[model samples]
Target: MLNRVIEQFRLKVSSIDEVEDSHSSTVYKCNLSNGENVFLKIPFTKLKYQRELEAYEILKGSVPIPEMIDYWSGDEECPGAFLLSELKGNSLSTKAKPTIAFQVGVLQAKMHSIRPPAEKALSGIKNEFPNWSHFVEEQFYSFAEDVRDILDEHLYNKAIETFKRMKQELPSAVGPSFVHMDFRPANIIVDEEKVSGVIDFESVRFGSTEIDFTKLYRDFLSYDDSLYIAYQEGYNSIRPLIDLENVLPFYRFTDAFNSIGWCKRRGIENNALFLKENVVRLKKWLL
Candidate 1:
């Protein structure tokens, strides 16, 4: 397959190494004969390929992200692949300093500020929901069904009640916006204490900006008040920060709930720790 990619793209490569952290895609770091470094990514599904490709088209100039150099929209024999310019950096660590958090916040705000493409221009992007709240509700119901057998009876009932409460009490979304549904430290790249780029946009979709903050908070902001404050400041510099005090708990709870369902789908054996953690969180929050 690599040889086929090389032949089809007419790429002159010096070296190629598989990137171990890629979960949803088979990724390779390739150093070209001309000394330019690039990444070759073959997404697991056509939907994922379309989402990432459309996300690049939307974010190219506005966000700090890798350049999409070349692509193959795959035929029956192979899945789609993208050759992307390497953004020189390391994945942002969970323990990164406040400065990087601030940059991440700014970049996130920039992403949210990008208006969705016109209705006719949506093409393959996943923007089917009428609104952000609708999207969240759909996510909860879908995942809830998936994990019905896995969750304890009492916990499942409590989760359904909590979802009802959230639906009734949560405020309307601030506005329609582009959300990076999987924003987290691992997807954020840092170079010399600054955010170099963000990657892994296969989960990108149209939703409220507030929905984007949950994972970042789970992984980074919850660890340090200073980082949270810095991130808020940076985001507010670009656009007004949402009132997290009221909305965060609901989003955070749903995030934990969805994670358990995700673990079930992906196999609890491989995600045992993650599954245990989220179950504990659900119990803590709901029971």
Candidate 2:
């Protein structure tokens, strides 16, 4: 079926090179037989093509997202999917540093500054980041089911317990600015070490600036604390840091819970490795 759709586009797929894979999609570098290169991202079952296409359309010129050239999606046969963009540059996050980190920080700040779209302008995409608390609350169900899959019993408990305590606290929230929900290093393509384009607006939501800001840590700095510090310095250079004390926990909850779900569906081996790593980072932040 996917092959049939590809044939409809008559795309000259050359060397189909694997680029990256996440919970929702897998990307390949499609060097076309016609000599042009296109990034082919096959959306997973969990992903909605309409959501991606809508988000990309709204963010087209507003952000440095890859412009959609064309897409194929419809009916149960296609299950509402698309393939339209690949930023032709290095993922800015492939190299982590004060420079790249700080630059990413500044670029994110610029993204946040774009004026909110008129409601009619974005009614097609679900713009409900204001309800992040509700979104986090839903994770509790997934969390309860995923405990046994977790390797480090101590850290696993820490994650569940922290999420519960944080939910109970329920602090007031902040800005619901235009956000690239998966605002991490892999989605950001770079040229000459400069951020060139933003990719994967699928997780796009209007939520706490903390959601976008903390990614500087998640994307590049989680494993690189020194770079995190540098990123902080760079981020601080551009704008005042929003008080993330309350929001980051929720952000971390969503991230960890999302991880568990991924493991549940995809084999737990690699997911366990990632869980061990990210759980440690989450614990460091909480501790």
Candidate 3:
């Protein structure tokens, strides 16, 4: 495997180390003979690979991201992979100061404000619904039956009722925009104080910008109220802040709901419990 990759690049292989297996892909850190460290992303599924490739092509020059070295469409002998220049930085910590979160929030706002090129926008499965209400309603019911068994019956039933009631209560549609879908510190690379690059475009799509904030609020802002204030302040600086009173809870619930299923599938007991707790937290916010 190493020899094939090295020969393709006409470079000697110094080392190849597994980084981490994320939900979408298995990542590897490869050091070339010339002292360059590159990342190799082998997607777990073909659809994810296609989305990541298309996203990189479309998002080129529009945002900060790792430079694409090469993309390989694996045949029967090899699995598809992406070779990219490593972003020289570290992911921001959840404990980062409010100011840092504010900066990230600004970048996120800028991303959401971009009008994706029409030809390159639909990178994933077309999720067409008649209206935003229907979309929210579908997401509200996305909790699979098997996953529901993992939750306390009371909590699960309450969640259903709340969602059923709120489906008709969402704010008016603000129209489709470029959404990072998974924007968070983990996907953001920070070099010292400035953001050097953002990674992971498999989830990029056209959607409500409010949906993009779901993870940001759950992972970061929920820990510190000040971060929420700073993020809102930063975002409002670029675009007018939407009145998220009615819609925020919906997206928050969906994020928690989806995360719960993901953890359950991976057999992460503790993480599943944490996400279940978040479901409760979101339920409270729904009021």
Candidate 4:
């Protein structure tokens, strides 16, 4: 089976080493007879496989992502997979400089400016829409479902009510823009101070820019307020600045709650505990 995949690419495989093994997918670094290497991603589910494939096609030449080499949609006998030209750098987290974080924000701004296709465009986790408040409401409910069992009933209800209030206060209309939806340092590829590419497009979609911004804030920028400021400086240089204060708390609650559920489902005790500890941070922003 492995030989067949290599043959399809018209290359004799010298060596194939497994690189990243995760719950949903496995990646391999395939060394060719010519010493060139490519990355293969084999996803456990078809939807995820197709999503990544389509994302690569849509963003090709437009976004700074790895180039797709070839793809095979699996049948009953074989699993689906895609091959990509291996990006030439480590993840952005390797350096963790404020300037790199700022560049990450700059890349995100470029993605947000791109107009997604009208039909067959990827939607948000719930569904994409023009109204940002409705999107926030959907995320609030979806997140509530994920973490209800693990959270204190009273605190959980309070969080929902807080989201409802914030929803009302948000601007009536927000343009539906392309957002990575899962933007994080791990998904950003960098060479020294330059952003070489961004990766992991399975969660790519069109939605409120705030969705991407919120993930950035909760995951990366919060660690250093200066990074947050630096990020905004880069982002606002390209596009109009968002009122993150008005939107941050609402998304923060949903993201933190969703993380708890993800950690619990994966049974990662330390991560779950770490996420649970942030519930206080959520409440402080709300109440």
Candidate 5:
């Protein structure tokens, strides 16, 4: 397959090495014959490929993402692939310092502020929904079905009730702006203690700016007060930061809930700890 991709793209490579961090794609670092480096990514699904391609197109000049050098829209027999210019940096460490966190916040704010071209709005380059609450509700119901057998009856019922209340109480649509749904330290690139780039846009969508903050807060900002403060400072420099006090619980709960379903779909044994953690989180909130 790699040889086929190389032949299809007509790439001249000095060496090719696989990258291990991806969960849903086969990624390789290809050192070009011309002493340049590029990433070769073949996503597991056509949907993933489409989303990433559209995201790169939308974010080309606005965000510090890798350049889309070449692509192949695969047929039924093979999933598609992308050859992207290498962004020269390492993935941001989970335990990133306040300075790096601040830069990430700035970049995220920039992403949230982007509005797609008026024509493309209806063309469906992004995963657009009626509103933020509607998107969340749709996801909750879909994920609930996936985890119905895995979650105890009482817990599942409570979760359904909680989601209903959350839908009623939380704000509906803050902005139908660009959102990187899978924003996290692992997806961010850093160099010399500064955030240089962001990657893995297969989950990109058009939704509330608030939706983008949940994963980052859960994984990074919540760890330290100073980090949160610095992040907010950077975000506010670009635009006013949303008040998360009232909505954090709802978003965080749903994030954990969705993760359980993701684990079930991907494989329970391989993600047992992840599944158990999310279950514990749900119990802490609902039970």
Candidate 6:
């Protein structure tokens, strides 16, 4: 299936180079004979493998996300999906010396401008249309199912109680935006001082701009107030979406709750502790 999909694209591959690895996928940088480079993602599961292909297709032209060169499936039209994307610049994580967080702010603001695809085109992205309260409720239940697996009984129940308290008086929508749920520095790429590419859309969903904005403080700026201030200045310089009171806290709580589940799936216990601490921190933010 992998070879068959590569055949769909006009790539000339003489050497396949392994580039990056995560819990989900193993990526290879394929040096083509045509001088065009592509990233080949082979995921561990068919479900995620297919989702990656779907995410790549829907997100094209919306951001600097790479275009899908080819996709293959075993039973479906594209099986065991193999994605080929033009090799873009260095990821933000690998090149943060000159400050990529500012670029991340601007890039994400642009991504927030994209509208969700039509029902038919939402092949890979999950939950195109959203209800904010229901989304929170679902998160509560998802955490419940994974409670025993992720943490002790006491901490899990405490999180549930915290979520229950904070979820009331939900804010009205400011129009749904195309948001990459994990819009962190690592998922963005930089060339010199500008952002050349935006990668990894698997956590892509249609939601409030807060979903994207929170990545600034939650991921890289957690311990650095100066970086957070600089990032906010850079982003709002391009487009305004700052609210120290409401949206900022919203993003924090969202990440705090979601991280617990994310940590459980990967068996990363440190995240569970982090989430519990943030739950305490988020207490003051709630009105």
Candidate 1 at 193: error in angstroms? 1.9
Off by over 4 Å in 2: 45-47, 114-116, 119-124, 148-159, 167-171, 222-240, 279-287
Span of 10 residues, lowest total lDDT, candidate 4: 121-130
Model 5, span 1-287: residue lDDT tens: 88889888999999999997687788999999999999999988888888888888888898899889999998776689999988878887667788887898899989988876676643325546465566678888899888897898999998889988886887656777888888877788888777878998777788788778888888789999889998999898898888887788888999989899989998999899989999999899996
| Top lDDT prediction, candidate number | 1
TM-score of every candidate = 0.93, 0.80, 0.85, 0.83, 0.93, 0.75
Return whichever of 1 and 2 wins on lDDT: 1
List the RMSD of every prediction in angstroms.
Answer: 1.8, 3.5, 3.1, 3.4, 1.9, 4.4
Question: Per-residue lDDT tens digits of candidate 4, residues 1-287?
Answer: 56666656676778889875244567778887889989877776777776787777667777799888889887775567888898887866633788987787778777777666766645323236555566556655765776687778888887777766776776544456767777876677888778898887666556777777766676678888778888888888778768888777666767776666666666656565666666666667656
lDDT of 6 by residue, 1-287 (tens): 45654565546688887765344566678878877678776666666765677666666776677767666564554436465666456666532542566666666677776666676555556654467667657765776675446555666666667666655644565547777766666666676766787776555677666556676566576556556666666667667864745656655765665665566666666455755675565444442
Q: Write the per-residue lDDT of candidate 3 for residues 1-287, one digit (tens) a residue.
A: 54565566565668898875355677778887889899888776677777788778766786788998888877665567788999888886777777877787777777767664665446353433225566655655565554586667777777677666766677666646667777877788877767776898776666677677777776777798887888788888888768766677777766666666666666766565666686676556544
Name the Cα RMSD for model 6: 4.4
How far off is residue 181 in model 5, in Å? 0.8
What is the TM-score of candidate 2? 0.80
Clashes of each: 0, 0, 0, 0, 0, 6
Shift of residue 57 alpha carbon in model 6, Å: 4.6
Instruction: Mark the regions of model 1 whose C-alpha exceeds 4 Å error after superposition.
Output: 33-35
User: Model 5: residues >4 Å from true position, as ranges?
Assistant: 33-35, 121-124, 127-129
What is the full ranking by TM-score, best candidate first? 1, 5, 3, 4, 2, 6
Least accurate 10 contiguous residues by lDDT in model 5: 121-130
Candidate 1 lDDT tens digits, 93-153 = 7678888878888998998887677854765576634666777888998999877878878
Deviation in Å, model 6, residue 197 alpha carbon? 1.3
